[model samples]
Target: MNIIEKHLAKAADLEKVSVGEDIRCKVRLVVAHDVTGPMAVEQFAKIKIEEVFDPQRVVMVIDHIYPASTVQARNMHWILKDFTKRYGTILYEHGQGVVHQIISENHAQNYGDIIIGADSHTCTAGGYGVIGIGVGSTEVAAAMATGTIDLEVPEVVEVNLTGSFKPFVTAKDLVLTLIGRFGTDGLTDKAILFTGPGVRGLSKDERMTVSNMGIEMGAMISFFADEDKDEGVAQTVAIELSEIIPVVACPYSPANIKPVQEVAGTEVTQVVAGSCTNGRLSDMKAIAEVLRGKHIHPDVNMIVIPASARVYEEMEKHDYCKVIRDAGAVLLNPGCGPCFGAHQGLAADRDVVVSTTNRNFPGRMGSREAKIYLASPVTAAKAAVHGRFVDPREPSGGGEN
Candidate 1:
């Protein structure tokens, strides 16, 4: 059995699921963000479900709409707050950070444990070796009440990775390259089992980037193997990390990818360096390494959001805040900033923005008329200072400097 199968089988032994040819498992935890939690809470109300099975197992984060964008948003936040208190569910209030980041910190993945979230990128929790899957608000509600949900045993695909990434190439770049090859709908409903030396070699933080974007290709779940034990899954695709180049998902889609060199020097109006996908301390250190003592371009509007309050404190400890803020970047309290264009910064019509966020679909960054580019934090950091796409491996992109 492959890793996914082994996980499901083990979960079946827990009360989470009963193992049969037809397997449906109980979710270990149910996580929701502000943007999606309200509906789930409303669903819980509709079902007349007043009490959660275990409040400690549910997490609600208010990251998407920071500081409450409007009166309606504020009211919704209050409703969520009330819900958390009334039911005893864990609640991370507005400005705490993105859902995925907080989940990673608090819910360390357990082997074979199944966790799900309302947000698609909840698969990101797989970085810690859990079977993290994303479901809708209704499913989240059900999990909150019963701690169980049915899952389609995904057809697992083995992504055998070889070689290693070089200087300036990152997990984001490799995932982007995979999306470029597989297209946006590439992994549709399939769980990608990452294996091989490449998978084992990646640090936990880097693995998060890959698992985070698993949904970008429409993946059901993306995770690395704990051991070389094969789960009898026949399908496999191998990726050579050494062959990947820094890539950007051009505007209007996450899979419309091109190598950075292919679009190098393309002008950008705004550059953002933060998101659940790329807002960790490792990411911050990478961005600051390139931006040390250098100022961002006058034409560029840059915002750097740490993934969590914890990440923010680490930045202060390392003086990364000084290095980045002094370089003219807006340092916002940890939350999902402008990644979805909720607040903090929004692009103007016809503007081109490069960001570290996972998605780049139409109007994803506020204006439908504006374009968004997706890249690694390092690439985004370089673009912020240069005001255009530049190869970070090039001399002008601070590759050697």
Candidate 2:
């Protein structure tokens, strides 16, 4: 059995599991944020159960609209707080960071653990070699009610990598390259197991960046494996890491990918460098490297958000916050505010933004008239400096790595 099967087998307490097989497995953790947690708590109430299946295994986060953007949001937060308080489940409040990053850093402790989140980007835990599944609030309610959930084992797609990445060619670039090759729905209902020697070079944060975008390509999960195997594999896609360059997902779809050079000089009004995808300490360091001792373009507004309080502390220790502020960028607290378009630095009409977030759909960050280009932190930082798209590997506009 491969990695996915191994996890399923362990969770099911079965000797083996097969692709397409239906099984009920014990879940190690169930996560939901402010947006989804209230709905799930409401659903769980319908089950008529007095207590959650296991309070320790459940976590609720207040991230998407931290500080409550509206009366409705405030009430929703109240629901989550009341539910967790009544059920004794863990609650992560405002400034804790995005749910996915919180889970990866705090709850996901063991390899091959079966983790579930209400948001699709939960696959971010795949960086820890865990089977992270993104399901709806109803599924979360069921999982919370019984401590178990049903699943159809998915086929595995092996992303075989060769060679090493060039400077400024990050894991975000690699995943964008994969999405470009596979199209948005090409890997629907499948799992991706990254393999080959090149995987050895990537850091845990980089792996999380790659896995976080797996949902964009319709993958069930994306994770790293010790080695490549043909048994129980559905297909294999090979990638040459050295050949990859910084790329972006154009507005309207993650699949609308183009090399950064192809879009050079396209004016951007805003730049963002944080999310569950690329809002780690290393990502901050990368952005700081580009903006240090230099100010961003006078016309552009750059918003830098750290993913969590812990990452924020690390950035402060390293003086990354000072570097970013000196570069004329605005710093916001850790949360899912701007990335989800709920609050904080929302793009105005006709705004063009270069961001490090995972998605680029219309109105994702603000007005439908706004356009967003999704790129790595390095690429986003470069755009902030020049107020336009510029290849991060080139010689102009602090592009040199």
lDDT for each residue of candidate 2 in 243-303, tens digit (9 for 90 to 100): 9988999988899999999999999899999999999999999999999898999889999
Worst 10 residues of 2 by lDDT: 224-233
Best-matching candidate per TM-score: 2
lDDT of 1 by residue, 252-304 (tens): 89889988998898999888888889999999999998899899999998889
lDDT for model 2: 0.89
For each candidate in turn, the TM-score is 0.96, 0.98
Candidate 2 regions exceeding 4 Å error are: 228-230
